[model samples]
Target: MDRIKFGTDGWRAVIAKDYTIDAVAKVAYATALWLTRKFKNPAAVIGYDCRFGGEMFMEAVAKILASKGIRVYIPEQFVTTPMVSLAVKKLKANCGIMISACNGPVNFNGYKLKGDHGGPMFEKDVKDIENLISEENEIDLELLNWNYMLEQGLIQYINLETIYMKEVRDNLSPEKFKASGLRIAFDAMFGSGQNLIKKLFPDEVSMHCVVNPSFHGVPPDPVRKNLNELSEWITHTRDIALGIALDGDADCVTLFDEKGNLIDANMILLLLIHYLAGYRQEEGKVVAGFSSTGKVRKICDHYAVPLIQSKIGFKEISRIMTEETVLVAGEESGGIALGDHLPERDGFWAGLMVALAIVDTGKSLKQLLKEVYSITGPFAFERVDLELNRIIRTRVIENCRNEVYQNFGSFKVIRTESLDGCKFYFSENQWLLIRPSGTEPLIRLYAEAETSDITLAIIEAARKTLVGEA
Candidate 1:
């Protein structure tokens, strides 16, 4: 087998391929060894999502950890990524494991590790676990009898969804949500978010809340292209005032306005910051991924809140959220974590907060966004993913590094920044970022300008300049 490696957040591979039983066992054994060293009496909260073989993989992880003499707590049913993270803190476990790939394609499955503080494992801890993967053979892969192990008090199954539901109830204002009288359409994308969101808001309309491992053949990501079903449903339904969709593991979300217009994460992040800082009077540092809109800086500056930019991924932003007083931490993607909540991303929390923000202000999403743009000003953003041949991708990166291109069509390269990716600045607010995907053979081009048309134009120009037209 190839060397087991982890990506930005976790280790994911095509199911029945690199993500086979032996692969999971390797990860589990490495985790067990790492946890044993970290805790005197190590325990873990293990859970799985709606992916194929979730339960079987969860059992495999449990068996491996139990064989190592570490106790395990698992959910009675499939749970979201945030639920597992919350369980780690609530159960006081040394760490947490999730059998999910977040929003990866249907054929993919993954493993995500969580720290004791209820967030993604610290970067150092993740490295330690990765190092241990190479020495997985050091762990004794003994198969402890399942029932016998349970009798010995090594495996415990608890209603993790109940605890997570209670946590959600305690954190969000249900009364405000009910009082708003606004119709909401939720699409779970056939992932783990199905049950809880339906139970949490039974009065609301929802879709794709069933156990479909295939995710209806569409990728389980909550992005615009993947969320066509929800968008169409909401747009056709006149009474639905909002549309919310969750990714596979339910840690991230995408929202749509009353008219079914896709509200990107940048606007959502800006709106959340505005609500917390302007309306709720909250204060602290704001941590955002490098791909987030520059408008975040404007919003933070407007509120006198310091803004810190990290490399893309919730793990990077979440690491800082755990150490500092973070008012809000989010990525350009839909993953966002609020202050006074678990440092980990919570789709339910983010959706509820957005709902509550609308209720508190007694305004529509468009109005709330207008309020945000009043401060941050209007900015348009777009991300273009290019799936090119390896040679072409490498050459593009080489050109970007060497500064071979002085202009992109009409947009000149006025400045260049390489904080995380190669960023070519056209003006102060207009820029383009070319970043390669860490886990996949794709180059992502991000463009931000004054309008959506300009953003798309810039991206297209960069694409032509880099890889040329097909």
Candidate 2:
């Protein structure tokens, strides 16, 4: 009877409260029904991260699927999101499910659904599942069985880690990487990326990989604030050419240069665009979310590639990717969907691509970034999350809908975009976006400028406006 609503990625809630066994059962039942109706006795590949109780949740869902005469393939051990995706594609399963909160706090957990193509389901597919949830019959608790399902061959255990490692080996060019002799350090942050560096590189790279479920009490977001140890280690070691950080589910990535500087997602986006457009000489369009930096536009313009800007979610980018030959589709957040791969965001793939780019160019990651800056000029970006009561948050955003900004210090609003939220574009390629966070009771302000000071000032002014102080 609990209200189970899916958010930006999937349905995530505090484990015992909203994500109770009953609620998870309901989701599993709904998914089974949806899959049965859509495919011929559909089978699913289920995976889980190293989060607490992840395996239990996976087993619970698998039992639910098996009870409904649906085949279920559960991983033998903890696996990353990309592994589930790969299994979905390799086994030709009807759907893929991963049990993880995906960079959220330790107290939370979630479920993600991947389509047949091994990518996040399209928005309409999620909507269809939601619709089915309302009409489906509640699952019978008496039908769930741990041993009977295994005996009946309804639930099969698979080796997703081996499958994923083989895929990485086939796709990644180790010879090119060894040519550079670049020593890379990876901080898995106690998420699913723990074994990836060792599996992919073997003895070729150095790494600091740990699978601590606590993640030192901080949410497993790969941002500068949470990656202090990685930064300090990279700085002091000096042998690491790059430090890669992956979130809890290993579906998003952030990088640190050899100098221990956290390279923002915008910089990564630009780097991918430059490599794909210039080096690979791939002629295709680029898609990015509105909160992304304008440096993407500069790179696209320089390469004469078409660029499409969409709303804040990677799902929107994924939608565009299906219709066009998108070279790269990414958001301001760490989610990246590369060309020819599944349209879903995979941090493991992103990290591998970063390594490949460095190898192909025969340059250090920092040197490659320097080249990108020379082409697009320098850009600084930042975002601030302002927590508020839900009612107050809604009212503040509604009130700002038609509000006009005459001036903010020396800046003037030149244009406004209300596609996802209220984005006020100012002169000099600087802008501020005010949008309500879908996953939390907060308003997020994203701003970018040519200098850090200007970016911070814009964020401050936007905060004042949100609080009615300006």
Candidate 3:
């Protein structure tokens, strides 16, 4: 058996390879053991996204937990990661198991654990479960009948979407959003987030909202390159005011302006913070991942609100939100969690909050961005993922750890910081971050500059330098 290792979010592997039924059973058996050890009468909430083998995988999990005499609650249909997390909290389950790769490639599937607090399980707890996976705790998945377990009252079905939709409805005022005339469009990329978005705003333009386990032959990630269809649709449609996109599991978000320009997550963070302070008259600190743009500091400074920079994970930011009075916690990726809502990242919720900002302010998205620019100045951020083989990737990461890189092409490294990834600073306004993707075998190059062109140039230079050295 290939050893299962959890990454930034959870354990992911290529389906039919490492992500087989037997592999899932081992982890499920371990989770069942952990739950029994921690809780006297433990129950588990299980859900899955629109991934391949979702039903089969979820059944296998349910069977294992039920055979252990544990109560298992699973959604009647596919749901988003947020729904499963919320269900864990709402149902007061001991843990949540969401069978999703979460925006990964089609060939991959993953397991994400949610704590009872409606957010990701802490690092120590996830590690404990991973450590429990062994041959001694094997589960004979073939011997368990899923229908029999359901009949025996050990496994039950639930309607998580309705439960989750209520939470979303309570937080947002759809009437006001509809009245704003700032028409919004959504692209689900054929992942699980489609149903909720469609239910929330029925009239909004939608693309790839249907279920396609293969993700229409592309990864369901909400990155710029994979979102040209949505962008072009919004650009061509004169009435469309904004575009919101959710990734595979509906936990991450991507935004596009009226002109079909991709809005950086940093800008959205700034807008959310500014909205909370200016509109809602809220008071709390802001937590952002380390890879976030420096403009967040400017926003927090302008508002006199405290700021906390965590390592590169929504779970890291989510942990801080649970402990601190955070107004907003965001990652450089599309995940943003509002303190007023659940601690878990909800793409739909984040999208609505930003759109609400436009409604309450009576300004266009561009106008709102200009207002932010007047304070923080205009800046651009970009991330480039370079897929490399094992040999080169190992060499580059080892070199980064030893500080072997002094500069990249014409850009000198003025300073360096290693919180989650190795960050090389060229100046106050320019820097580059070199880190490997936790879910895939790719080195990520992140850059922030005075302009989009400059950000791309810096990333390109660094990419060439890193690969050349490797």
Question: lDDT of all the models against the reference?
Answer: 0.87, 0.82, 0.88
lDDT of 1 by residue, 1-470 (tens): 67887777798899998888878988898899899998898999999999999999999899989988899998888999999998899989989999999888899999999999999888889989998885345444454588887898899989889988888788797767877788889999999999976787898888899999998888888888888878888878877767889999999889998878888778888989999999999989999999889899998989999999998877788888877999988888788898788899888788888998888888888898889888977789998889998888888888888888789999999889876778899998899999888666789999999988889999999988877733
lDDT agreement of model 2 with the native: 0.82
Give me the runs in candidate 3 sitting further than 4 Å from their true place.
Answer: 135-137
Which sections of candidate 2 miss by over 4 Å? 134-137, 203-208, 404-410
lDDT (tens digit, per residue) of candidate 2 on 1-470: 44667767888888888776777778888888888888998899999987778998898899888888888999888899988988898999989999999988888889888888777777788777766664334876666778889999999998988887777767776566766778777888888878887776666344336667776788888888998888988999888877788999888999988799998678888999989899999988888998899889889999999999988877677778778888888888899878777677888787778889988887888899999999989878999999877776877777668665555656678888887887788965798888887665578989989999999999888777666732
Candidate 3 lDDT, 369-427, residue by residue in tens: 88889889888898889988888988888888999999898899999999988999999
Clashing pairs in 3: none
- Say which prediction, candidate 2 or candidate 3, comes out ahead on TM-score: 3
Error of 1 at 159 (Å): 1.3
Worst 10 residues of 2 by lDDT: 202-211
TM-score of 1: 0.96
Query: In what order do the candidates fall by TM-score, top score first?
Result: 3, 1, 2
Of 2 and 3, which scores higher on lDDT?
3
Candidate 2 residue-wise lDDT at 420: 83
